[model samples]
Target: MKNIYILSIGKVYRKSNNLYFIDKDKNKRVIPIEGINAIYIMNKVSLTSNAIQMILNKGVPVHFFKEDSKIGTFYYLGSLLPKQKKPSGKVHIEQVKAYINVEKRSEIALEIVDAIRYNMIKVIEKYREVYDYTKTLRNLDVRKEFEQKMTDWKDATNVIRGIESNIWVIFYEALDKILKTYKLERRTRRPPKNEANTILSFSNALLYATVLNEIYKTHLDPTVGFLHEPYEKGRFSLVLDLAEPFKPIISCRILIWLINQGIVKPEYFKKDLMGVMLNENGKRVVIKEFESRIRETIKIKGKGRKSMLIFIRKQAYNLEKALVEDTKFKAFRLVY
Candidate 1:
């Protein structure tokens, strides 16, 4: 698993042989080259030719952000994130073709919802004994009302909540027995103060945002998603579409794992005057764990293939293609 290294700690400068890390004030620090998947230069992080050569040889992509935080330069291994400045008009036409299959899109959207719901059922099944969820899903005339409900899924909270509650029930009996020490509970959208949910949401957004940004680099456009609604303000709903079933299993497991392993203790974070924020040491713990979890393998069903961290972006790209081509969209199911 590779890492998207955040040069947030300090100025990143290139040294001989490998990339060297330096602080803002002026202190040389050595960086471990083994774990980096990509490097993000959020600001004016510097690198030398020798250092660039080493990073390039390792096939690490380097990204530079402008003052406004818009992505400015993309450094592919030895090159940049890629500038398809002259995309073939024919390819562009094909991309459009993939994006505009109306009839196929409707079927794909339904299948994608089914797949997401199916995986969601697994999340529920983990907690409760299977009673008659088949009937519940069968009654879901969401298909007929998708056009409207997609706009206001806040109404569907009752349904999503029902499913979430069913999932928690199964764990309820076992959780208290196993997690007696950490005092665990099934958390919903908002996590309690002094808990790790803030870090999880922040990390998840960072992860999903990066993947969505990268998916755009491919021939696939970010619009025309199946599960999520397309609204204003550059809403990359497609990424969220893919991220739906993932949040509980991936991030939830990460939170539990970090707690059980003592990587992050309750003391690592504090509810400040503003809100819950991880202290310096706590940020390091979560940042590292989030990157590691991103790289962790989650067996994806239907594809019959094993996926790593980067495969997430690839899957999102595949979903975009599936949606555009009117093929059935297979949601990424996380096998626990």
Candidate 2:
């Protein structure tokens, strides 16, 4: 199945049980809903209720985005039980209970942090083979302190957030050494300052929405989370929690596009009151590369040469299994 992206100003509506895209120039195109699993509306687009109904009937989620920032998602209410017909609320109950208990929450936090740490280190090693990352990162004891302080009454989420911040610091520092013209000083949202940050913000949002779509095909509720506080309107925090480990995969691709391949040119970006943003061409380049990267095959322990997208859904299903069976949840680590 493929993802249908409405990237231009258009109106997408259902016609005789099929979806079509009509651009401002009156150029009409038919999108076969049979092979499409999700729709991403990136720009100004009007959707008829008939289109929404058709998407829901097909059980395909519609993700709306304003540029790189995600606005909302529309999917069926009963999309949680991918394999079972009835809703089993047991997994959600276990997830919330684990969040309430400090020890349980700390353990979950450690699992996430460990995965992030391992992948962060791997990314550095993969890019900068000449540098000694272990010696360079020896002074930053964020993970060690994170593990020790997680059990305290202090919020476990905040502790994990702190370690996440440190990991980015080490990550960007190593990245600076690799890249020639671009440098990432700190992470930025809303408006990305530089080219690298611009690509990162845009691609990370893609990853977030992708993971949320995958989570919908599982028994777990996306609203309830362990590392992030579950907000009523912000039900995607759990997807954010699950997105931590897979970041290096996207980050590696972004670096390759920006510095190695030199494919992302200056004209691909634009500056406005919102700082710097990817133009249509830039977004197309990033999305094309990012999608290709996710589809690339990698070896899983038991599952041989699985695509990264398949691994993400498998990880989500594994989390659901952990919640239901009361077993340890392990995040996905890059095979390299």
Candidate closest to the true structure, highest lDDT? 2
Note the residue pairs that clash in candidate 2: none
On the 0 to 100 scale, the lDDT of residue 201 in model 2 is 73
Q: Estimate each model's TM-score.
A: 0.63, 0.85
lDDT of 1 by residue, 253-301 (tens): 5665676676667777666444455555665676677767776666664
Provide the overall lDDT of each model, using Cα atoms, as 2-decimal numbers: 0.52, 0.73
State the lDDT of candidate 2 residue by residue for 49-84, as single tens digits. 887778777777777766432221112122212234
Quote the lDDT for 155 in model 1. 40
Cand. 1 Cα-lDDT: 0.52
Off by over 4 Å in 1: 15-18, 24-37, 41-82, 85-108, 121-194, 259-263, 298-305, 320-326
Q: Which window of 10 residues has the lowest lDDT sum in candidate 2?
A: 72-81
Evaluate model 1: give its TM-score.
Answer: 0.63
